[model samples]
Target: MALLTYTPEIAEARDKGHPIVALESTIITHGMPWPQNRDMARQVEADIRAAGAIPATIAVMDGEILIGLSAGQLDRLAQTQDALKLSRADLAIALATGRTGATTVAATMICAQLAGIEVFATGGIGGVHRGAELSFDISADLQELAQTRVTVVAAGAKAILDLPKTLEVLETLGVPVIAYGQDALPAFWSRDSGLKAPLRMDAPAQIAASHRMRARLGLPGGQLVANPIPAADELPSAMLSPLIETALSEAAAQGISAKGVTPFLLRRIFELTDGASLAANIALVRNNARLAAEIARALA
Candidate 1:
């Protein structure tokens, strides 16, 4: 009956009822350049540990659904090329075949739920792309949040996405989008995306209490905690908006559509911003790790 498996560390944490936060593997295998990616992965895990929780960075390898990775696994993953980016639909196939794969936001949530982890932390979630209307392209993360009962703390949807539409879809799915200590939603690297969040909660205890309430009320899904990047790390909407526009224009010109849009835009944005975007991403992810730890501790 146990279709999925966990690493020893994660299994022990689960047995001990320790506070554990789930991290996606895509950030290591696909998010950044090597060495930096491995370093950032360790740093985020350390941040969670410092905040009194264990980190479970989920991935699939050698026919096992690895709930946490060792240093060697992380280093190898970062250096390995063409790691299959697995999502909800492909998660089982990857595991069954023993293929090495990185977990996206949606797949990570599923793994977290399977591991009995209540919270997840990540840099930014994938969402509605710029041309969703025409291309019908949207990220499965939105629907995943609406069904999985794991609270996710993220900076917000990536700025390259259609922010307003993504928010709309989350609302339609009845997902609670709570901005942490802020009135407006964050736009990944930016402090504010100029759109007001559906709800706001300042304390991790309050967020934890809300998670309990969702269970009490028999809610199907989880909450979206949108934490803004720190002022010093924020790229500001002013800078990001134009860069996003340029990236979208370039994508349009090249006819980059569907699944290719996100990676294409992110690569172009990295070049356009001279790596500032990547830096901000790492900062926000660590920040989310800290908050997610607090929530997990409260849940414990």
Candidate 2:
């Protein structure tokens, strides 16, 4: 049905076998406020270009999965209040209904692989949420990583999640979690999670080579690159832990759950931090985009 549509830039890049980094669109539609969301999306795309790769910001709209968004499309998406935050489960339904939707980490990896793009960058991936034992509120992103063949680069699982459980689940699923240039895993918005990484790679080439090796071994899934946020931009984990606890308590009391949990917590934390959380979020996303572009280039 010609469901995959590409903008001219991405189409050209694909034709020429150039590196392309796939970006998820929820960051545009749900991650930030309008003008700021648009601005962040543009800056991240620019960072990818500056790093010598094309950026493919993926979303589903008008019965098609767009591999890349043009400036106008990006602007429209940034302001789309009703867009679905799609994951592996609902992506096809959104497309089938001709509904505009923003891609999350899982959906982005799926679309990226379909487009033959190998790398994706996001601020952080969803994971086992805190208190998942009772609620079973784990995110689909981890499962997607265990099946999709697109390497995802991010700071780590969002700090609001149960990081240790997230790492354990990733390990159980055979997803390789590699820390970039560090031994400790990074928490989103922070440079370190204080948890030692299962693996570490000092260079993008090394990561790319591992990706190729996995293919050679007939591996089914992709790699997770835990790229740390730059030191200057990190919100220290110590400073954030108490605030996170407070936010979680509030969410529990207010009965926020399911897909609504993460965003609600993020919003509350944003308030608790007096806007610092969002600023840190923007920085880490840019950092991840730059690294994803490098990994894409290495793979190309």
Candidate 3:
């Protein structure tokens, strides 16, 4: 039996050979609460459309991988409770068990490549956690970027992570971390992570050309376009550092580990910042979506 289901919009886009940017669904199901998530999803999709590309928001439902979702489906997904947060390891399990799952960066890239889509957008990619040497708790996203052939656009690795360690791992994996129009890598809610980017590309066309060049050279893995969040929406890293440190400390005290770490940090940060972090998140995601659309068009 076929495992893929393309929403009508995505099917039409595919038929026409139009540029389609893949979006991960975990942002809808796990990133925010209720109506807000739905609204953000809709707005991001609209932003992509306005930028002249199709949006393919990927997820797993009823034993199949959905390349895109209809309006009703997207609404249902945004309201879904207990949806599996699937990555490379568990994506197949969710499909085999006919369970609903929201794809993370790694899983989304896998799905996008399978569907012949070449570019993906997300708020941020998971990476090395703080004190990873002892915990050895690195995210699967790093390994996925090393093997996948899709170009991923994001603000950067979450500010809650060890950005330096994350960059080191990405370098080790041979994943090109290209800062979009900047010299510094972006931290999720912050415009700068206080670290220099390994590569910088100013134009979407240049990024697209690099992606094609990689494939032509028989290189494995994808490119990470670290698109910085807009200045007006960013929370300066100087202000966020203490907040993130406090959240991290709280998580350690509470013994939160693995999958629980990110959500716990985000929630704590939201409370600490009076919901400002969430607003910044929404803005950065929409910004990334717009850029992803441009890159997709360039690739096409």
Best by lDDT: 3
The per-prediction CA RMSD against the true structure, in angstroms, equals 1.3, 0.7, 0.8
Candidate 1, pairs of clashing residues: none
TM-score result, candidate 3: 0.99
Instruction: Give one digit per residue, the lDDT tens place, for model 1 in 256-281.
Output: 87666777888888899999988988
Once fitted onto the true fold, the runs of candidate 3 whose alpha carbons sit more than 4 angstroms away are: none
| Sliding window of 10 residues with minimal summed lDDT for model 1 | 1-10
Residue 281 alpha-carbon offset, candidate 1, angstroms: 0.8
Prediction 2 global C-alpha lDDT: 0.94
Candidate 3 clashing pairs, residues 3+ apart or interchain = none
- The digit string of per-residue lDDT tens for model 2 on 1-300 reads 897999999999999999999999988887888798999999999999999999999999876899998888888888888999899899989988899999999999999999999999999999999999999999999999999998999999999999999999999999999999999999998889999999999999999999999999999999999999999989999999999999999999999999899888888998999999999999999999999999999999
The Cα error of candidate 2 at residue 27, in Å, is: 1.2
C-alpha lDDT (0 to 100) for residue 188 of candidate 3:
87
The candidate 3 region of ten consecutive residues with least summed lDDT is 1-10
